[model samples]
Target: MRPSLSAFKIRANMKPILITGYVNPDLDGTAGMIGYAEFLSKTGKNTVAGVIGEPHEEAKYILDRFNIPYPLLLANANDYDEIVLVDASDLNGLEGKIDPNKIIEIIDHRQAHETDKFPNAKAQIEMVGAAATLIAEKFIKNNLEISKNAAILIYGAIISNTLNFKGSVTTDRDKAAAEWLNKTARLPENFWQELFSAKSDLTGEKLAERIEGDFAWFVLGDKNVGIAQIEIIGADKLISERGEEIIKILDKIKDEMQLDYIFQNTIELLDCKNYLVANDEKTKKLLEKILDIHFVGISAVRPNLIMRKQIIPLLKVELEKN
Candidate 1:
């Protein structure tokens, strides 16, 4: 999932914009999409947000909270001259939502290596925390108002996409952006406190569920290795309480799933003090002894907890090295 610009063969001249895909209607996905589209519109691009999939129920909460008008359901995608993709890490997943010939730019926080050859777009991927953080920045760059609801959505996006920044993908920019958005929009700690409480059923789900839900695998030589992300924000007290327990569970999942390699990163979402887990003692030792990192390497666990969007790209990076 490393960033690839092959899909974006930028044209010398461009046309109007039509932002599309990942209209999940979540704090991260929808807000980021809308925020970016708003930027295009302000620049006089014929911009619209398209959601190929159903919007998540939470989208309503965030949109209403921000009072930002949801983009109308596009009657057909071909009317727009160019398309900007947001939030979607996988472009192929956006089947039937757009005209293949019209894709022009992809501004996402994902690390998909497939840069489809399009002659009029760009791929702005910073395999870091939330895409919404980038979107928020774009809007702010345009002097757009940081409405209370947009703030909430961006904040939630920061939390969910980076797993509260516990994963390896989070950077100082992400934290700073989240902080800025929170201050401008007046976000409260109480909101995140409640959201973190919804545990991802760690009791006894299959190891495969934890691995599949949270991890993406890659073929590294003869061995198949995987990476998972867990973002824990400074604002959430619960992360400190249960992060280790979750790591142990993820370890069990790797063993049961017969994976040759496993890597886990437990990062402080608000900043970077990443905790880690690796299956191979040699790898763990190298990670700490040479890289000055620390982690617990073990086996057998359940399915719970995830930091998917960030984990997949990190997995890609490791695979290339392995």
Candidate 2:
């Protein structure tokens, strides 16, 4: 049974319920927390959005562009009576700031993690491409008033996560949510193109930040995998200039972190293509065969694959077999 928050209502004046995104929140995470917190507030639960870590450049840009207030940085959720997790539910993503037991609700679109920890919390996990899509749907379904800023954030998240609906994991729900949000948001026609360009503004100076911005760790087939993605406009140029250096960095990370595989993919947003880099040839060959795209040097050129959401599952299945 889907858990209901009706029984968990706030009595009189109390501390506002806390809602937070995972550490190092991306656009989807930021948007999801904002939208869901707004929804809960309207439902008679005072809620405040929080972030476990600083917003990434893309999320910060979108929030600033829309004039949406930034979520408060949360040191911990120990003081809050209830907590809602958006975009991510893993304990590692929380960085041990908030106890998993304190989470009262989880609204995520990613694969379930730490499921046992939140056994009593209401979980709304959908297989959609983006968590923002699920939250946007809540606004529409509950007939909640979506402020223009909220709509814009949700729309931006959907666009960013789905790569304008070109990503493999995008569903009809995501498209529908985008249409609904765009109706009131009326975002500029060039918003997506401009945002994509902005996201690809990584230069040599921001190389380390670019690598760690979207990094995640996963356990696949008894081996810990550290995966990072770099979304850029000049994938080929970047690779040609610093491919060796990037590989060396990945090698060091793999060894120091005891990661069996450290994979990095540079996605060219302009052409909607990707090239990959990894610490080892075995990992590269596996990705090539699984993604059905050969590598050009260290980068996988235009593999027609986009979104780590699509790639991770494929890797999991293959890794299990190995």
Candidate 3:
């Protein structure tokens, strides 16, 4: 049953509810921050959508389409009734904008405080692909009407984070949540397809520079190891045109970053196989190589796209072997 609305509702005189994103708000964080803000406002509190990082283009479209107001900047932290942290990993960085005692809730989809970092948080760490999916569940569980804009934002977040549900970390829960919400939001299929097709620079880069930008952290032994996601579309063409450059830079990355291992991954979306450029024969034979089925485009595991999908489980497998 839902709680009583009377206690939750604020008089018009109350401070605007601030809805802020993670330190660097990506599509997931941006969508979750705003979508959750919309839900909170429907419960009768004035809301302000905040961002430590700016929203991406698609998210900006949703915000504009929904007519959601841009939130006031956090010049100083002492501003709102309760500080809501969406995709926020660190509370200290946002110190001046929120009182340590005033934070009421934290919501995210990533692994929460494996190191016992945030002692003061009442956070939702559900290990799903996207935080937007969780906020959608909260609305449905509470029986709130989801706005059209909310749907698009969350859906975009899911699609981006899950890499069109192809990322290994994606689960049935993530699939179900995105499926349910997208029905009402009613965005065109081609729209998303075209939107996602905008390729980032996976090709022309040094491995060291590439890994820093595209990595997600996972526990490897005592240290938190970072695995990078490098996606290039055509296997043969990429090899012919840029393979030498890739190998050179990747070797450079191995030395520069001191990586335990690097998986230079390529995905031809048309063909499902994942090709990896590894540092050595030992690293090459690591994951998926054990299965050893090479068809037109075949591999048992596609572990290079998203580390959450590929690296985390691979770490578990590697740890057991050693």
- The global C-alpha lDDT for each of the candidates, from Candidate 1 onward, is 0.58, 0.82, 0.61
**Model 3, backbone clash pairs (residues 3+ apart or across chains), number:** 3
> What's the number of clashes in each of the models?
18, 2, 3
TM-score (all chains, Cα) for each model: 0.58, 0.91, 0.67
Per-residue accuracy of model 3 over 199-272 as CA lDDT, tens digit each: 43344444344444444544465433444455434554664566566666666666765766555555544344
Q: Check candidate 2 and list the clashing pairs.
A: 275-300, 276-300
Q: List, residue by residue over 256-301, the lDDT tens digit for candidate 2.
A: 8898878887777777788877757888888888788776667776
Better of 1 and 2 by lDDT: 2
Among all windows of 10 consecutive residues in model 3, the one with the lowest summed lDDT is: 291-300
Candidate 2 backbone overlaps, count:
2
Q: How accurate is candidate 1 locally (lDDT)?
A: 0.58
Off by over 4 Å in 1: 1-16, 23-26, 57-61, 64-69, 73-79, 198-306, 309-322
Candidate whose lDDT is highest: 2
> lDDT value for candidate 3?
0.61
Ranking by TM-score: 2, 3, 1
Displacement of the residue 109 alpha carbon in candidate 3, Å: 2.9
